[model samples]
Target: MSHDLFLAAKAAMKNAHAPYSKFPVGAAIRTTDGRIFSGCNVEIASYPEGWCAETTALGHYVTGGGGEIAEIAVIAERMAKVTPCGGCRQRLAEFAPAEAKVYLCDDAGVVGTVTMGELLPYGFKGGILKK
Candidate 1:
């Protein structure tokens, strides 16, 4: 599963539309039922509308059909952990459980892994939306 996710993320990174930051990123998430969704960073002239790779992947997952994300993989060029950004973290919390595994990778492959809870300890769940 890790290998498959890594490949998915790597494939997505090849198409990153990062004209501004040049910091291309890719993300892939696997649903509990064994479906994989992947996306690459897409940047727009207006930074506010640009979506992170994680958010884009999550969107794909939801749009296809609602599912619980069991695992996430992120790939970037750098050696550092390529975890999701703050906004992406919040987006992930909505579909992934607190213990969901998140894999961080570079061109060479996975560099590390962490749980969703660890990445966003105090994240805002969808409780407000439920109300």
Candidate 2:
């Protein structure tokens, strides 16, 4: 079921623009409706100001008429199971439900899996902001 998402992530990783770090990363999001959106890390001379692969994927998801996110896949050229960063975790939680699957992938395929809640146990809740 997740093999396609892994493939999308792997393909996106190949297009990453990380010359400065030389570490390309890719991310893919799967909507509940089976739509897949993939993105690669884009870096510039401005250092850490560039967006992450997950962030880029989220941008696409939102622009494509945001839907319930069911699963996610992340991959990097250097790390076998590179999890989303702190900010990316929160960003994912904003759209994906707590039980949403997050797949960690290596060069070959998915190496591990975690839930959105597991990724950010104490993350800020959007509901709290509305209160």
Give each model's whole-structure lDDT.
0.88, 0.95
Tell me model 2's lDDT, rounded to 2 decimals: 0.95
For model 1 the TM-score comes to 0.93
Candidate 2 lDDT over residue span 10-76, tens digit each: 9999999998888999999999999999999999899877989999999999999999999999999
Candidate 1 lDDT tens digits, 16-61: 9988888888899998899999999999999757998888898899
Return the number of clashes found in candidate 2.
0
Clashes in each model (backbone N, CA, C under 3 Å)?
Answer: 0, 0
